[model samples]
Target: MKNLIKINSKINENGSIDFKELNIDDFKEFDYYRIVNPITKEIFYNDNGKLKLIHNCHCYDIWGNNKSCDYCVSTNALVTNSTKKKLEQIDGNLFLARVFPIIFDDKTYVLELFQDIGDSYVKTENENLQLSQIVTQLNLLASKDSFSGLFSHGFMYNKIMEITRDNIMPVALLCMDIDNMKYINDNFGHYEGDVLIKKISDELIKLNSDNVFAARTGGDEFQVIFINYTKEMALDYSKPILDNLEKILIKDNYYASTSWAIEDRIKNQNAKELIESADSKMYKVKDIHHKN
Candidate 1:
């Protein structure tokens, strides 16, 4: 089945399909086919032998998912320029998707061929749904903090490595720490300290979006990475958190306060250096709070 799809179909310099000896008729064996720009998530399909792009239509729309898949095979194929396959469930039916990296108009794209395999693979719709839920839970357990429900420290480290390796620019990192956490724990008890952490997590979660990745990196330390954002923009986005924390009263008139630092990715800075820079700047802010 893998041999049916060619690995690298190239577009000619003149802007015509080279096909690279690939027979387009072989695609007919699949139930449906679509060309996708992995970065933009745009969907394009053949219309009477001509390719046409669908406006505002994403591949995830077919799966009825609100966002992109956590492990996106199409994006993987585009990144590695390799053929990949994954089983996707849509509308209670199983689909086998074979992704092949191709060049269209000198830009990389993925050709996704989907064939329905529900009857052969899935026993019942309810069973499939249960399996999907279990997988989602396992993924959450592996990547998320148990108490705060934000991403774990390990996940944040891996994400930083990915961003650095990929050289994704215009990124900002926000390092945050709850001020006087030990003081709160000693005076109010550990339970109250836990409550304060959860309150801080709730505030951070409110800032989460498609471009924001928030993680609880330590006991009272949180980090947020903003993609495609400048340092100024990231600071502006986080100002509300400071204002909100000032109003949160945990108990006994003690307010939930935090010290944070925001730093933009600099040229040639690795993941470790970037994180260290942010952490150092955060401590400076904490020092100021202590002096007061």
Candidate 2:
């Protein structure tokens, strides 16, 4: 406190002196003074590093945390040029008093004022990343079958409607079911039956093409709907899936049978109704397999 009192007394004693007579030592202990480069917006301050100066006039809350005010236009101008001009003072919550060009040795430096701005910029960026992750999870849950990871029945219907609306032709729907799947679960372990379901779904998805949509619609039941396809095209598409199934079974030493039917002739039926028709036909094929 005694030292501060002495400093203040010295400043008062120098009152009314010509400004040019003052030197750097005159304000050596001044607590609040800043030097900043105008073009880079970089800031410097007195030896204590407590006060930063630039040309903006706003309250602490307005500019965000540690952000200087926006109205420091004159300070910015001085740092960009090489001449001295009369300083101007303007009104605001805070404003720059003057812009001084400091020439040290051969290089030039600038001095400006700064004020605090608030802290919302970083928070908004983090919120965007979290929102993106949520959208991705919701889509996965909506499109997937909970048990088999195949397409859900609702997704299949939506796809059929979407394709048909696009001016496609010769659409066919084929519903399929595993023959005696429940019987296998009753006799063998449910784990073994689950393996069979997974195997069938894998084979079906591998048959994906521009025209086909495959899904496991229910337990032990699956379906494929083909767009822009004829009866012959449907059969040709099914052949690869059937052959793949035979290879998988022979490799695993497990026997599972599936039945599917193409409902291309039923043009009058809507998507759901068409799937039902193919489902009924699939049951007939399953019954024949059972009898044999």
Candidate 3:
């Protein structure tokens, strides 16, 4: 290790290496390691306690469940100690490095090192990066709506196709429009209107059931796709929002009316068609409210 460091010092003019971020070439050049502050969840240092150089990569692309992997000396050291006893004892895939605590002036620091035994460490690094990317993409697909935080028209259509493929279950679609939304935006502010949309969305979220999915279909218009819900359930769920309209207006010092259309699962109905039906109903209801 001493000889390796001595040789590296001559080649590495800058005199620093990021242990956690080491590739095969880097692993070969420098004895790499890491230091992790468990409490803070901060990977403070790499080999020789140096700040790592961040490449032009997004956080999701670079780090997965393994954070501060680039500067992991604690892992390297464990691999080192084990390899010294039996060359064959080193495992290629599974590597665990022991963490050593350095206490100085009431502060404790831990360091971990990596041991390279198998194929070129570059291959391993690339594989890890690929895995990180896949995990990120999967999470994004699962957690977020295709368009904005609201369900996209296309996404809703796809879901409807799947849910109504067979006589599998009953589904209901509730479409809504923010009444006088354009007027509010023009009079009060666009920013306030945006806030109102978010507030209404939040209120809808509070009213959601286990099987309920809410989405923003268009500007000032939203929908709730209810799977296996009865007409009574749909009406009951909507009452909260309708009842709370005055409270929301008073709290925010702005008046916003809402109109809605509801539908139940029927033969040959798709998400697009369902949305259109609800939208038409909503418009009719809106006209009635305006006239009154």
Cα lDDT over the full model 1: 0.74
> What RMSD value applies to candidate 1?
12.7
Candidate 3 residue-wise lDDT, 52-84, digit = tens? 423333221212323322222332222222211
Off by over 4 Å in 1: 1-137
Residue pairs in candidate 1 whose N, alpha carbon or C atoms collide under 3 angstroms = none
- Ranked candidates, highest lDDT first: 1, 2, 3
Better of 1 and 3 by TM-score: 1
The count of backbone overlaps in candidate 2 is 17
The estimated TM-scores of all candidates read 0.56, 0.50, 0.50
**What lDDT does candidate 3 reach at residue 81?**
24
Candidate 3 scores a C-alpha RMSD against the true structure in Å of 18.5
Q: Write the per-residue lDDT of candidate 1 for residues 144-178, one digit (tens) a residue.
A: 67899887675676566557655646889999998
The deviation in Å at residue 91 for candidate 1 is 22
Give the runs in model 2 whose Cα sits over 4 Å from its true position.
1-141, 163-168, 246-254
Per-residue error for 287 in candidate 2, Å, reads 1.4
Better of 1 and 2 by TM-score: 1
Model 3 misses residue 209 by how many Å? 4.8
Distance from true position, residue 115, model 2, in Å?
Answer: 39
Per-residue lDDT, model 1, residue 154, is 56
Q: Pick the candidate with the highest TM-score.
A: 1
